[model samples]
Target: MGDTLIDEPTDLSVRLATVFSQMTRVRTFRLMNSAERGPWPALLKAVFTTPSLTCLEIWESPWRRPEEKFTIEALELPQNYSSLQRFVYRVPFSDCFPRESKSYGRRDRVQGSVELSNLRVLASLICDSVEVLELPAELAFLLTHITYPKLRVFSVQGHEPLQLAEWAEILRSARQLREVHLQTPIGFTEWSKTSSNWIESNSIPTAPVPQTHSDDLIMRGLSNLESLTISNPLDPGKELFFQFLPYANLRTFSLKAFPPLSALGARWSGIHSQVLTSSEILCILKGIQLINLSTFEVSYSVDAEDGVMLSHISSSFPSLEKLEIHRYRSLAKYNSEYDPLVSMPDALATATNLQHLMLNLDFPERPYWRDDNLNPERYKVFHGFLESQVASPFTGAIPSLKTLGILCHDAFSSYWDTWEVSKTRKLVSRPPHAMSN
Candidate 1:
C-alpha cells in the first residue's frame, strides 16, 4: 500500500496523458508549484503529445526571476500548442513577468502569438487593472489574428481599450462568439467623450461606451447572443438599456447598480410611449418566454410608484417560475404612505405563478405611534383595507404560490409584528375554496 501510494501521482499523470491523447472536445491541465521548474518539461511533454486537446488551463505559483524576485510568465507555455479550443491562465500579474520584459508586451498579443490554432473560448483573463484609453497594438494584432468563428465565450479584464477600429473588426470577425464580459477600470471618463463619435462611425448608435467606448462594439458584435450581463455600476441609466434594447433575442439579462425607474422613464421619454408602457412590458415578457427564460431578477432603488410600475412590468412575465424583488433600503422614505399589511396582500394576489417569492419590506421596526396608541381613525382605515379588501382578493389569485419570504429591517420588527396580526386575520378568514391541502 505504501509503494502504491508513493507511485499514485506518476500513475495518475500517465493515465491523464493517455486520456488527453484521445480527447477531441475538452481537456484541462493544471499545475500548482513554480519553485521547481525541472518537472515542467516532463509535464509539457505529456500535454503536447496529445493533439486533440480543446481546453487547457495552466496555474502555477510565482517563479524566481534572475533578479531574485518571483514573476509572472515564469511558466511559459510550450511551443506548438495547437488544437487548443479554450485557454485560461490564472496567475498573479505581479509575480509572472518582469515589468521591463519586451516579450510581455500585451496580454492579447501573448495569447494570440501562442500556437493554439483552433482556440475558440477564452475566459477570466485576470490582470491588475484594465485600461480603456490606449490598448496595446500587439494585443490588437493578436485579437485580429486569433480565430473567433468557433468561439462561444470570451472575457477580458484589463485597463486598456482596444482601438475602435480594432474592436469593430473584432466584432465583424467573431461571428459565433456569443458571451462576452469586459472589465475596464480605467480611462472610462475620457473614453466616454469619444464614444458617440465611435458609435456613429461604426454605424452602431448605441449608448456612449463609458470608458473604452466598447459598449456599442460589444452590442454590435454579440448580435446573436441570448444572455448578457453588464457590471458597469457607473452608468446604469435608461440610455444604456435603450442602446441594447434592439437585441430582441436576449432572454436573460442582468445589470448591477441600475438607476431608478423614474430616471429610466425620463430619459426614454420619446420612446416612453412605445417602450415603457404595459404593452411593451408584455412584449418583453413574450420575448422572455419564447427564449425559455424561467428566472428573472431586477433590483433597483425606486419609489412606491416605481415599485408599482415595476410590478406592472413583472405581471407581463407570466412564464417566470422564480422572481426576486430586491428593494433597496434607500427607497424606504417612499414607503411613508404605504401600509405594509395592505400593500402586501394585493402584490401577493397578483403573482400567481410565483413558486418562490421574497419581499424585503424596508420599514422601521417600531412605528412612531404604538399600535395601542395609534390614531383610532387611521387604525380603522388600515384594518379595513386588510380585512375587507386585501385578504378577500388573495383567495383565488395566488393559487400557485408555494413559498413566501418576508424580510424587514430591525427597526421595523414591531411593525412586522403588527403585520403578522394581519396574517392571522388572513388565515381565519380564508374562504373554504382557498384552503390548500
Candidate 2:
C-alpha cells in the first residue's frame, strides 16, 4: 500500500479511494481550497468512512461563487460520522436572503435549496457528536432542523442576517455549548426592543418544525456559557453584549469594536461619538456582577477616561486574573492627551487577583512590517518607559500581577512586548522569541 496525504486537492479516483480505505486511522484530514467540486464527493466518502477521524477541515476555493453549493452527491452516510468531534467549513461568505425581501427570496430559494440539502446531509452525518462546529452564518439555519446534542464550541462568521428565532433554536439544541464566538455584525433588529422576550415572526419558517420559544431558550443558554467573544467591525451592538451578562457563568469575555471611519482618514475629524461613555458603561454594568469572570478583554472604545470604567470593572469582577484593553483599528486620537500607561495602573489597583494584563497603545513612530533591519532603539525606549513608569507602578498597586504586556501596532510590526515581574519588583522582558501578536 502506498502512503497517501490528502492535504492537497486531488482528483480522487479508484486508486485514491483504495489508498484511503486501507488506512488504519485518520485522526485529522484537511482539504485545502479547491475550485473544482468533481473530486469532493469521492474524497468525502473516503473521509467519512474513517471511524477514527476526529477533525475535518475544508476550505472552499476563494474563487467560487458565494451561492455555490457544497454537494455531497451520491455518497452514502457513514455510520462512523459520530466520530467527528470538530468540523470546519470555510467559504468566502454566505448571505441568508431574508424572507422579508419577497422578490429576492423567491429568486434565490432555488440556488439556496441546493446548499440547504447539502447541509442537511452533512448535519445528519455528524451533528450527533460534533462538539466543535464552525461554519458561515448563512448555513446557521441548520440549527433549526438538527440538534447538536454534544456541541460545546460554536462559531459563525459573516454578516448574514440571523434572526432571534434562529439564535434561540441554536441555544436550545446546543445545550452543552460553553463557548461562542461571533465575528459578524449583529444589530438590534426586533430583539433590541425587549431583552428576553421575542415573538416569532409569522413569516414562513426558514427551516422545518420542532420549534420552541426562542426568548426562554436564549435565557437558559446564556446562563451556562463560560466564554463569549464578539468581534464586530460595526458597533459591538451594546444591547447584544449586555444580554449575555449578569446571568452568564462566563469566565472569559472579549469584545472587539472597530474605530469609526473618521479615524481612518475620513472627512469627519472630530472624535467619534460612539465611544462608550462613563455613564453608558455604568448603566450597562449597573446591576451586573461578573464574579466568575477570570479573563476580560475589550477594545479602546471602552472608556479609559480617568480609568473610572476600568476601576469599576476590577472592583466588580473579583476573580479577574487576566485583563486586556486593546484596539481593533488605529485611532485618530493618537494626538489626544490620553496615555494608557499613565491612566490604567491606578485604576486596576483593585484587581487584587489579576495576574496578567495587556494594554494596546499607538506606536511613537510608524514601523513597517517589511523592514527587517528596523531600529531596536524604539522598542528599548518603550520597554524602558514601561519598566520604570508603568510596570513599576503596577507592581505595587496590583501585587498579584506577574506579567505586563504593551501592544503596539506599526506598519512594520505589531506584537505584544511583554515583561515578567519578579519578586524583587524588577521588570524583565521575556526573550525576543517569546513576543507574540
Winning model by TM-score: 2
Clashing pairs in 2: 367-412, 368-411, 368-412, 369-411, 369-412
Question: Model 1, 29-77: lDDT tens per residue?
Answer: 5454443321233344466456655445543322222222221233233
Q: Over the stretch 54-91, how does candidate 2's per-residue lDDT look in tens digits? A: 88877543222233445444565544345889988755
What shift in Å separates residue 125 of candidate 1 from its native position after superposition? 16
RMSD of 2: 7.5
Model 2 Cα shift for residue 276 (angstroms): 5.1
**Clashes in candidate 2: how many?**
5
Worst ten in a row by lDDT for model 2: 193-202
Task: Score residue 260 of candidate 1 by CA lDDT.
Answer: 22
Best model number under lDDT:
2
